[model samples]
Target: MVVTVPRVSGQVRDALAAAALAVCAAVAAAVWPEVRPLDAPGLLLLAGVHAPLAVLRRWPGRALASLVVLALPYHLLQYQHHALVPAEVIALFGYAVLGRRVRVVLSVVALLLLTCVVGMAMRAGGGSVREQIAVIEGVVAIAIAVQVWRSHRARVAAITERAERAERTREQEARRRVAEERLRIARDLHDLLAHSITLIGVQAGAAAHLVRGDRPVDRGELGEALASIAATCRDARTELRGTLQVLRGADGGPPEVLPGIAGIAGLAEAARAAGLTVVLDDEGAGTPPPEVGVAAYRIVQEALTNVVKHAAATTVEVGLARDGDRLAVRVADDGRGPAGGSPRGFGLLGMIERARSVGGTLDAGPRAGGGFTVTALLPVADVGSVTPR
Candidate 1:
């Protein structure tokens, strides 16, 4: 259905003008013979009220007061019947449309009361009890109009506030639903992909051992492939668990630390099993806090995994050094070159994100002689201690 737009201010102006015009015509008709014939001054005063009534909303009290004073002499000279007129009605409407403060209304009403008293005392010809009653009735009409206008304004304001509150509530609910969906996806990735990749490393290591010296596959190549699988699994687990914890709720336990400097030996062992010559060197052996240590371990692990996946290096080297408050890990491969010698995608991005998440930094690129190198620095103290250096 179509709806028409309303112009409230324009409508108010038109209404007030129409009312004033009617009153002017009435006064002219009732008092024309008694005064002078219908002419310029009479018609002009009658039309003047209508023009100002359009601006009554902008200046209600002023308009109302001006009209009352103007009406006085017109009534006195024309027809002093102590009767209600069109101008009086328009003045009343002006008071209602003005939206002035209650204090202002009270003050204006007090003036009207004084005017009523004086008008009664002066009492124009043949103006008596009946005339006084008519004047009182006009004042009553003005007061009622003011009250009705105030009530309409208050109702409109209340509705606007309610609508705004409802909109905010809906937006919050949408965010909550989106968060829940993310957690569900995280749980699926953890259970299905992370666990599957881990098993691939175990199987690959075994396959390399079984094929030792007789097959087309080099035992060392198989071992490096397995090592890469294991590292990928660990990284996936860390990312997946972090996501799922949000679904479980904010009250979940501290983050699961994937292994740190201490886990370097395990990494070396896995790489060896896969047949790649691997070495691990630690400059500082102090145990670090779960977060920093985990970040450090993951950095080295991912770098080593990348070396196995992309580097043609037969030997991988990992070095860890702690300087003052910081711990740094460096992983390098002395291989033919990166498998395709082209760096791409999530491997490097994940390493950078892991380092940044724990307030650390990472650098990865090609080495001078050949192969690829990755260097990472983690703030051990900043992330808190897992164990003392």
Candidate 2:
């Protein structure tokens, strides 16, 4: 069986050391021939010097002062001197390692003065002045070495903290970018599927109505409805393929051409196929920046999708005009505004996010006259280039 010995705490070890030093000083005072015999006052002074070692780390300034105070009398009264030097060294080392600069300087000066007084006393008792000078040098060396070690440890700790802070900042930025990319992809998928599926549903319904009617089915009308469904499916497939390419991180071909302001006519045509009269008015001057154009196209697309899906009205007017440095887009439909009062849905939220992402604003609400209107003001000039996501 292995016997495990518990580790001693720093305070406990320091106490043991202090007690051992006290015992040693007492023994030396009693038996050493060159020093005076141990007495009550001398024993008290020895205790004062060694006892502070037990708490040297916790209170370095106090410990060093205690040692210096008691050691003076011990040396002046000519008690045994050698045993107390170890305690003095420990005290000085503790203060240098932990004490503030002003206190350390003051303590060092006090200790040097005490050392000079001791050397003078020893000289009168026939001790060599050279030995005292060497003792003073040793004390100075210990204080300087401890201070250098402390400074080096402090510098290392500061550098480690800075590196850790930089790592955390990088991680936070990466997470933010990932979140933005996910939101952009979701908006794209929603707009693509919603428009295509809504159109296909409307066309399929028309074809079914013609077949189930009591009158003989109109073959031309039936064919037109089927053709619209087929065309919508084809467009949806192309857009899905492009989106998939982006998801797979492929750079094999020229990028998919995104629909922009020019694509509004196509949207209007699709809505017209769904049995709505669409009036498109384009009053814009020159072409907008690609980012602005894409935003405009998506907002119009989403607005029309909402109209076809929910509006019972038969007419929608889409207007695009340049107002100074901004492009104004407005979509209005004679629809049963929004069901149950407020205009709230994921489609509207996505449109708002897209507008704000390019430093623009969108307002959507029911017109007081009887329909819903979505109006967006997009910057047309000097809108900084954006990477397609």
Candidate 3:
């Protein structure tokens, strides 16, 4: 998608070339007849050599080839070389620009042999050897000059291609870093809000029900629940600010304390407050890396959040285990399954992304027992031991 117009310098060069070709054609037409006998074949050869110059830029190889094919017979049949004969040298240069060097070299050698043979024939029929030698020298000098020109152009083109590739590689890296940063910020936001919001909703509902009922509220329990809700809100707000500050690049690094594998208990408590009976069992080996920990915590948190919103289940089970080089997590709920259920939305999508980011795999679907199950196998401290998916 980018269109570039010709530079003024290039346009000027093309104009000058067109003008020069026109002058050559005019001079050849008017002068060649005066020098040699006026002939129809000579005029046609003149036209063929000059006319192809117009299309040299568009198809330099083809135009040069045509000129060479036309020139052999034109020079051979003609009784003597005319002023217009040097036009073939210009075609040779054009061929060097767009064609192969070996081919050009071969062509020059062939032309050399042909000219000497013609000179021999001319000598046998009354011609001069010295003039033929002069022609050979001119042809050799021109071929050498054209080869040098082609070498320079080839070098310049190679340098230009290398620079373009470097620029493209830099651009792709910048885009990739930007995308990864955005994903980190998003995962932070989801972890902070999903669990806290669910807990706050449950606490608020309980407080409302207690006040609305005929029973006198236990002021201490009511106060404690409200305090918990306030504390959760405060933490959520601070976490959000940290996440945003990181996104803006004002923060030094990730929030010093990201919720990790250890924080799954809070997710369970939040589910309990939301009226889901949650049983959590964590059995793992060596500690996971920070990135893997964050991913694991977020995956569990999101799974529980989905249960609170859609499952309406009475019992939920959460498990974490480390086997060999992998960390495995499973969340199963005994509720109405995904069939005839509301779309799970971006929550599951985010969990899947989290899993993959840490070189993990996720599988979430309805269980055969009329519930839903979300299972993930993630690379943890032993990430280097496993090949990337």
Candidate 4:
């Protein structure tokens, strides 16, 4: 199959470059004395000087070799005909760009120096010594210019390559962080909806049953169930709204009042509303930093939610205390836990990840006597925040 190249930036650059070479060649040939006819040998020699430029960018070394052989004979045979022979000088520039080969460049410079010498000797009868010296000076100036231009081009190419690599690295890092944020949001929503809705479902189902029972219904019991349902829904709504705002990114205003060690009492109240009595004890020094506070709040919240869902217990004790540099939190329910001392679900996994994010640790298992317990130790440092989705 034949391949076609699309006109990308690099291809466009090459086209502009080829056009520039064509212009240079035409200018070089245009200034010669009375132009030779298309059929004359002089015109053929002119083609040898100008035609190789068409491929100079693609094959600079070969073009330099060819231009040297062609321009040498033309200079020696017709030194007095044109004021300047540009082909050999232009070839030096092409070789400068396409190579780091010092030997090849030096050889070409020596060849051009030889041409200037031979041309001056041949024209000694007509041109003065000063004029001959001036010609050699111009050739030396051109050689120095080619060397300087080549060094600058090499430096620019190296710097450009380094810049491109850095840009690519930044893009890759941004993509990776985005993927991690999306995953965190997915997990937070899962925990919030799964645990909150389960409690709401239980309370709502109980309220529905009592109102429609065969026997005379107790107004107080039905009232408590309905109240619990309402409270759960309110908590879910508030938490979901705050989480969405966090996901949208922070606006420079007062931070949302998130759950922390102080919020454990509120969480206990919520659990108590769901028909379980929860007791809370606080022994920490000052308020924990927002990160430690938030992780502590989530740990307690998740544990109590588990108690309501699976514990089938009557009372839960929530405790918070500062142990040296760590804020330790514990939630123990006097109800039967899973026989294996572990819950096979993302709930425990989310709790563990939360603790780890804040440079903390968590342990949960069945108590020796009866119920289950979740204990966590959170560091009060700038490890990271466990921000909700």
Best by TM-score: 2
Worst-scoring 10-residue span by lDDT in model 1:
75-84
lDDT of 1 by residue, 140-207 (tens): 56666656666787789899989989999999978877875654454345333533354455556566
**Model 2: CA > 4 A from native:** 1-10, 22-43, 57-65, 71-85, 92-133, 385-389
lDDT of 3 by residue, 1-389 (tens): 99999667654565467557646754655564432443677757766656666666667777766766665655555434444446657766766776655455546555754675564556444343445445556766777777777778788999999999999999998998888877766766776777688778878888888778898988986886787788778867776776667566675655536667887887787677667899999865347887787778888988887787777789999999887778888999999866565345678888888888778999998888778999998877666554322
Report the lDDT tens digits of candidate 2 across residue range 144-211: 66667777777798999999999999999899889988998899899899999999999899999999
Report the lDDT tens digits of candidate 4 across residue range 171-193.
Answer: 99899889878777866787678
When summed lDDT is taken over every stretch of 10 residues in candidate 3, the lowest stretch is 123-132
Which of candidates 3 and 4 is the stronger one according to TM-score?
3
2 or 4, greater by TM-score: 2
Pairs that collide in candidate 1 are 23-86, 220-275, 223-274, 286-389, 288-386, 289-385, 289-386, 310-339, 313-335
Ranking by lDDT: 2, 4, 3, 1
Error of 4 at 46 (Å): 11
Rank by TM-score (best first): 2, 3, 4, 1
Worst 10 residues of 4 by lDDT: 31-40
Better of 1 and 3 by lDDT: 3
TM-score of 3: 0.74
Candidate 1: where is the Cα deviation over 4 Å? 1-21, 24-44, 51-258, 283-285, 336-342, 384-389
Better of 2 and 3 by lDDT: 2
